[model samples]
Target: MELEIYQVDAFAEEVFSGNPAAVIPLYEWLSDELMQHIAEENNLSETAFFVRKGEYFELRWFTPETEVDLCGHATLASAHVIYEFLDYTDQAVVFETKSGRLFVDRDNGRYSMDFPAWGVREIQVTERVSDALGVRPDLLFMGKRDMMAVFEDEQTVRDLKPDFAKVVQLDGVCMICTAPGLDYDFVSRTFVPEEGILEDPVTGSAHCTLVPYWAARLGKDSLIAYQASRRGGVLECANLGDRVKIAGQAVTYMKGTITL
Candidate 1:
């Protein structure tokens, strides 16, 4: 079988500056095993597959090792594909996903996605979490799928050198270290050793937890965020009750057909 694929740089204004996600739009669902194989072969942080379903699309995201319930960059990339490549004329796109209905709105050159706010609660900072990150957090918050380690400043987050081997042993989906940004509202770096990602260049879903926490802490409804990964990325964030809006730009990097 031959399938067309697109690689998009999400949360970036240029190629090679943001997280890259593989997006494949299909007319029908392929077998789960085949999709997993394709994602593994691509070897990007996340690969998104979607099929049109009436007014909305059915979407799923896969890491190299497993399927995740929600992914931000990949979802942005998928919307980019739909708008730019799939001849979709609508300015708004709705996706039926494992996390329920997700909406992306396009205006001018940016895409804003509405995602569920992940519940976060203060947690005791264990030695395992501190040792894995190689830095003690000022505060620790536990989300549904990940943990947030809040530091005092941006330098603390940027200076971190995590022990991925140790991180893998710590319970939870992944770890995110964040602090008040020098230029933006906040800055963050994500690591997903359990999902085979030593470091995620730009994690959109992590912002779900970050947005609500920072908004409440900063006493603002809207804010700007930066993911301080090696590649780096910028996002416009807003906290609205139970939902968070994440906005960013995507640039297409490559387009090709994969043969299986």
Candidate 2:
């Protein structure tokens, strides 16, 4: 079988700067095992597979190890492929996903995605978290699938060199470290060693949790955020009551065919 594949750098103004995701569009669903093999071979943080379903698309995301419930950068990358390569002319695209209905809108060259807002609650800072991150957090919180460690400054979040082995032993699928940004409204770094991603660049989904917390803390509905990964990316964020809007630019990095 031959499948067309696109590699897109999401939340980036240029290639090699943001989170890279492999996107494959299908006419029909492939076997789950085959899709997992494809994602493992691609070896990016997340690979997105989608099938057009009338006015909307059914989308799924996989890491090298497992399928995830939600992924932000890959969804944006998939929408970029549909609009730029698949000749989609719609102003917005809807997706039926594991997380529920997702919407992506194109305005100018930027793609804005509407995602569910994940609420977080304060949690005790455990020795496991502190030892994994090599520093103690000012505050710690738990979300649905991730745990957040709030720091006092952006530099602390950026300078962190965590023990991924220890992070893998933590409570959630991902360990998020964030702080108030000097240039932007907030800055974050996400580690998902448990999901085979040691660190995620320009995580859009993590912002779902980040945006709501920061918006309430800062008393603002809209904010700018930066993911302080080695290959960093910026996000324009808005915290709605039950949802969040994440906007960013994506660029095509490579296009090719996958043979199986």
Candidate 3:
């Protein structure tokens, strides 16, 4: 079997600066095992596979190890592929996903995605959390699928050198460390060693939690955010009580055929 694949750097103005996701558009669904193999071979943070379904698309995301419920950067990359390569003319694209209906709109060169707002509640800071991150957080919160650790400054979040072994032992799919940004409204870094991604470059889905938290903390509905990964990314964010809007640009990095 031969499948066309596109590698896109999401939330970046240029290549090599954001989270890279592989997008494969299929006419019909492939076997889960086969898709997982493909994602593992791609070796990217997330691989998005979608099938056109009338006016919308059915999308799924996979990491090297397993399928995930939601992925922001991959979704953005998928929309970019549909619009830029698949010759899609619609101003917006709708996706039916595990997380429910997702919408991505294209304005100029930027793609804005509407995602669910995930609220978090305060959690006790554990010794394991501090050992994993090498620093204790001032505030810790638990979200739907992730744990958030709040710091007082951006430098602390950026300077973290997590022990991936210890990080994987923590409860939740991933851990998010965030603090007030120096230039933007907030800054964050996401780690998921269990899922084969030690750190995510530009996490759009994490922003679902970050936007709401920062909006309430900063007392603003609109804000700018930066992910402090080695390959960083910037996001334009808006909190809408139940949903959040994350906007960023994507660039094509590679396009080729995958043979199986």
Candidate 4:
């Protein structure tokens, strides 16, 4: 079978400036192992697989190592591939995913994602958190698939050099260390060694926890965010009571087809 694959840099207006996700627009579902191999072959953080089902679509995410329940940047890439590549009719697309219903809106120059506000619960700081990060954090919190450590300032988040192995020990999807940003509302970085990913350039799901965490700290519903990964990404985030909207632009970096 021949499948169309597109590489889009989500949250970036220009190519090679944001998190790149591989998007595969399918008319039908493929085998699980094939999807995993395709994602591994892409060698990016995530490769999104989707099939149109009426106005909405069914979306799945895969990393090099395993299939994930949810991923933000890749989902955005799928939306891009459908609207910009396949010419799906609609400025917006709804994805019925394992994570639940996700909506993506095409804007004047960017895409806006409406994601659920993650329920973050505080937890005791394990020795691993201190060892991996090489510092003591003020507090620790764990969400459905992420671990967060509140730092003293943006510098702490920037200067962190975590032991990726220790970071993998955290019982969550990813490891996040965040603090108030001087130039933006908040600054953060994500690590997911367990998923065979060292650092995620841009994590849309991490912002779910980040939005609420910063909103409560800054006493504001809307704010700007920056991910300090090597590629780097910027986001305009807003908390809308029950949900959070993460807004950023995407660029088509590469387009091709994969034969399987």
Candidate 5:
């Protein structure tokens, strides 16, 4: 069997400005071992696989190391592949993932995704966290992926030099150091050494937590967010009822076929 694959950079207008995700639209569900092997070979932070199932598609995400329950940028990239390459002309596309039913809207030169709003809970910072980050946070919170650390300013968040080895043991998928941006409304940087990614270029999942937190703090429902990764990512965020809509751009870098 020949399987088609697409490599897309999600959340950036340019080809390589955002996080890269491999979108593999599969004809059928392959064995878990094979999927893992494919992802390992790809060596990307996340590889998305999807199979059409009626009106929706069953989507799954895998890292080079293991499968994950949810991935935001990869999901966005999958939507981009379906719209741009799979001949999907509709204005909207829906993907039924392990997390839940995710919907993507394509319009006005941007792609918007309605994803689950992961409610974050406030927590106290410990010596371990302080030592790992090499700095102190004014406020700390817990989310699905990582511990949310609110810094004094954008510089503090950008200046973070966390001990990745220790951060891997602290907890969650990654550590988010965020503050109000000087240019944009908010800025964040995610560190996920545990997920085999040192710094996720632009983490949409992290914004699920950041959007709500900043929305409540800033008393606004909409925001412009910037991820301070080396590659960088820009996102327009909005908080909905029990859901968060993250919008960004995706550019296809490579597309090819894989013989299976």
Candidate 6:
């Protein structure tokens, strides 16, 4: 079978600036093994596959090693494919995912994603956490699927060189290191060696947990954020009552055919 595939730089205004996700739109679901193989072959942080289901679409995300419950960058990339490549005219697209129904809206050349906010509880920092990050954060919070480590400043977040070998042993999807930003409201860096992504340049899902944390801490509902990875990315963020809005621009990097 020959399938159409697209590579999009999510949360970036141009190529080589944001997290790259592989998106494949399917008429029907393919075998899980095959999809996993495809994602492994693509070798991106996440590969998104979708099948049209009436007015909505069913979406799944896979890393090089495993399928995940939620992924923000890939979902944004999928919406980009639908709106820009598939000739979708609607202002927004809703995707049914393992996490739940995710909504992406397009306006003024930016895509805003409405995703569920994850609740957090304070966690005592352990030796493993310090060993993994090589820097101890002032505060630690545990979310449903990820951990938030709050540092004192942006430079600390940018200078971190994680011990991925140790980080992979932590019991979470990824370790999020964040600090107050100089230009934006906050900044972060994500490490997920177990998911085959050492550092995600831009993470939309991480912001779901971040938006709420920062909003309550900073006393604001709307804020701007930056991911301080090497490639870097910017996001316009907002914290709703139970949901968070992550807004950014995506650019098409490549379009090709996948043969199986």
Every candidate's lDDT: 0.95, 0.96, 0.96, 0.89, 0.90, 0.94
Tell me how many residue pairs clash in candidate 2. 0
- List runs of model 5 lying over 4 Å from the truth: none
Model 5 TM-score?
Answer: 0.97
Better structure of 3 and 6 per lDDT:
3
Candidate 3 accuracy as TM-score: 0.99
Per-residue CA lDDT of model 3 for 126-225, tens digit only, reads 9999999999999999999899999999999999999999999998888999999999999999999999999999999999899999999999999999
lDDT (Cα, tens digit) per residue for candidate 1, span 12-42: 9999999999999999999999999999999
Task: Residues 1-260, candidate 6: write the lDDT tens digits.
Answer: 99999999999998999999999999999999999999999999999999999889999999999999999999999999999988898878999999999999999779999999988899998889999999888999999899999999999999999899999998788899999999999999999998899998899999889999999999999999999999999999999979999999999999999988
Error of 2 at 86 (Å): 1.1
The Cα RMSD of model 1 versus the native structure comes to: 0.7
Q: Could you tell me the TM-score of candidate 4? A: 0.97
Query: Residues 62-142, candidate 4, lDDT per residue (tens digit)?
Result: 999999988889988888877776767776899999989999988776889999998689999878889998888888998
For model 5, give the 10-residue run with minimal summed lDDT.
Answer: 89-98
Kindly list the per-residue Cα lDDT of model 5 for residues 4-110, writing each as its tens digit. 99999999899879999999998889999999999999999999999999788899999888898888899899999888888888778888887889999898658
**Clash number for candidate 6:** 0
- Please report how far candidate 4 places residue 232 from its true position, in Å: 0.5
Model 4 residue 84 lDDT?
77
Which residue ranges in model 1 land beyond 4 Å of their true spot? Answer: none
Predicted candidate 3, C-alpha RMSD: 0.6
Off by over 4 Å in 3: none
lDDT of 4 at 72: 89
What TM-scores do the predictions have? 0.99, 0.99, 0.99, 0.97, 0.97, 0.99
